[model samples]
Target: MSRTLMSLVVLIVAVYLALCAALFFFQRSLIYFPQPSAVNSADSRLKLAMPDADVWVSTHERVGARALIYFGGNAEDVSRNVPEFAAAFPDYALYFLHYRGFGGSGGSPSEEAIAEDALALFDQVYASHPQIAVVGRSLGSGVAVRLASQRPVQNLILVTPYNSLEEVAVKQYPWVPVKWLLKDRYESGKYAAHLRVPALLLAASDDEVIARDSTQRLLENFPNGVATLKIVPDSGHNSISERREYWRWMGDVLNR
Candidate 1:
């Protein structure tokens, strides 16, 4: 090769190495967005004791035997979910987990850590109410699916869920080797096969983030008759809960 051509090749290789190193080191920052722990006016906060970290929870207190535990999106402050959860399930007590590093919870967020925190929280809540439902939206769906697979969840609701973060990451960064670089895979599909309880998948008709096929693929991963798929009309991934009939459907899931 000519000297100029050889020099160009060396530069390209060096740049590619630098990019891969950055992706390997800082990929968690790209994956998990830790938002400030903002509390809503209607929320009453509680701290659940975990071995390594303390998890903050937003609650809509209602004296009842049935309860609902909700996990929010990556950037979502779970406190905001209180009002809607209250309106949707008036009779059931509500608990929304503010994930680690988000919403004033202690420690950095990771798939393994959050999964452990979820199991601990579920065990504590299950102590009071034997009949409990788990609801997860977007990123939280991964955590919730893993929780249900291990625990005795009465009901499971996944909104705008993807099969795995790897799949979603691959969709967004086709050129990058996301499958190998991603640390917290959050492979909900892996846990779906083991979950035996009734699951309701709320898919958006026009999801700009998670594709329709991504959510459908996760639903298909579940065993026969284990999960039911519902599409919210004229809705996107974030706006699926904004549909007029959304609460009615969600209420039915909790009430079941």
Candidate 2:
């Protein structure tokens, strides 16, 4: 081998290693986008105690056994959904969870930490409300899936959910060995076969974030009749909830 060719090969290897190292250390920053709170919590928020941080949940107070627990997107401020949920289901108490480091919640966000906080919230909600519906969107879908599989969740709702974080990460970073590098693989598909409760998956027709095929693949993971997919036309991943029909569908699902 020529000296120049060997030097070129060495440079390429060094660059590849640098990229891998960067991804390994800063991967969480790519996954979790913790945003500040826009909604005032003085009127309606619940502080769920956690060792790492206090998780803030937007609460729609209602005296009933039927309640809804919502887990939202990575960058979403879940407090934004509180009003809509209150209007949609008057009888049901709504609790929208803010992932760690997001909204007013403290502590760095990770798949494991968020899941633990979710489980804590579920346990507390379940104790008071015997029949609790768990709703998760995007990143939260994985947390909700795991929670539902472990708890006796009455209804499970997934919005723009993917089969696995690793799968989605691989698509986003085609050159990266995501499977090996990823520490928090939210593999919702893995829990699908174990779920017996009815699940509703909301998909966006023009979703630019999560692919339609990814949502479809997640539905396929569930057992026959275990889950149903509803595609919101002319809506992308983020705007699907903005559609009027979206609330109507949600109302019908929760009411029934």
Candidate 3:
């Protein structure tokens, strides 16, 4: 091949690789961004209300053992889990937070924005309820860890979480440069390590999307002597809630 032609071809290949990397790192924005839609919770038995910033909350009871706030996965409605949570902690009040653009909430969704919303919700909930616990699954883990680090939380629970979305992107697209390209660095792993409250980290053995090691990385960040790590057998990323042991484990944790 001629020298000029060879050089041009190499340059084109490099540009293509760079573009692929950009797309890979920001893949979640490309994949998970969806317009918020108002979902009907009229039939829900739990008392529903929106106190701030396009977020919806479901409460089981005002007077209970403790208040529980739940953050859900990227595609999770979260309100759907109200019944299950109420069943699990019937005495304690249950709260579900809708992300900026998830489930009829206003504004666009971003990692920092969601974390701010979580902190606001935590503050609002904590103002009245002294005993507060935070629970998060998947993408919501980012919000949970951030809130725990910022606030005085009684307990923290993370399910099917990753160290960071950026890390996950790199794993999914090894050819891509995720570190520089990702706009939303949901670095839950970085925050989880410093939490002082009791923490529960749950990993799925059969999670095909997020590896167990990634979840372990988040667990490792937890401060010494206060973390409980559990691996659920035969459970995938989405099926952790379906397992009977999940409820039993949570009951034990809360009781502890």
Flag clash pairs in model 1.
Answer: 37-103
Residues 1-256, model 3: lDDT tens digits: 9999999999999998878876856666763644433345554322223344555555455665488999888888777787788887876677787777677676667777777777777777777788898898988878888898899999888888888888888887687666767788888878877778998888888998888788877778778887888988889988988998788888877655
Candidate 1 displacement at residue 245 in angstroms: 2.8
Task: Give the number of the best model, judged by TM-score.
Answer: 2
**Model 1 alpha-carbon miss at residue 6, Å:** 1.7
Q: What TM-score does candidate 1 reach? A: 0.95
Stretches of candidate 3 off by over 4 Å are: 1-4, 7-11, 14-18, 21-28, 31-39, 42-53
By lDDT rank, best first, the candidates go 2, 1, 3
Residue 241, candidate 2: alpha-carbon lDDT: 94
Measured on C-alpha atoms, candidate 2 has an lDDT of: 0.89
Model 2: per-residue lDDT, tens digit, 137-231?
Answer: 99989999999999999999998899999888988999988888999999999998799999999888899989878888899999998999998
Count steric clashes of candidate 1.
1
Model 1 regions lying over 4 Å from their true place: 40-43
Error of 1 at 33 (Å): 1.5
- Computed on alpha carbons, the lDDT of every model, listed in order, comes to 0.86, 0.89, 0.77
| Weakest ten-residue segment in model 3 by summed lDDT | 43-52
Model 1 lDDT tens row, 105-146: 899888898988888888888888888899999999999999
Best by lDDT: 2
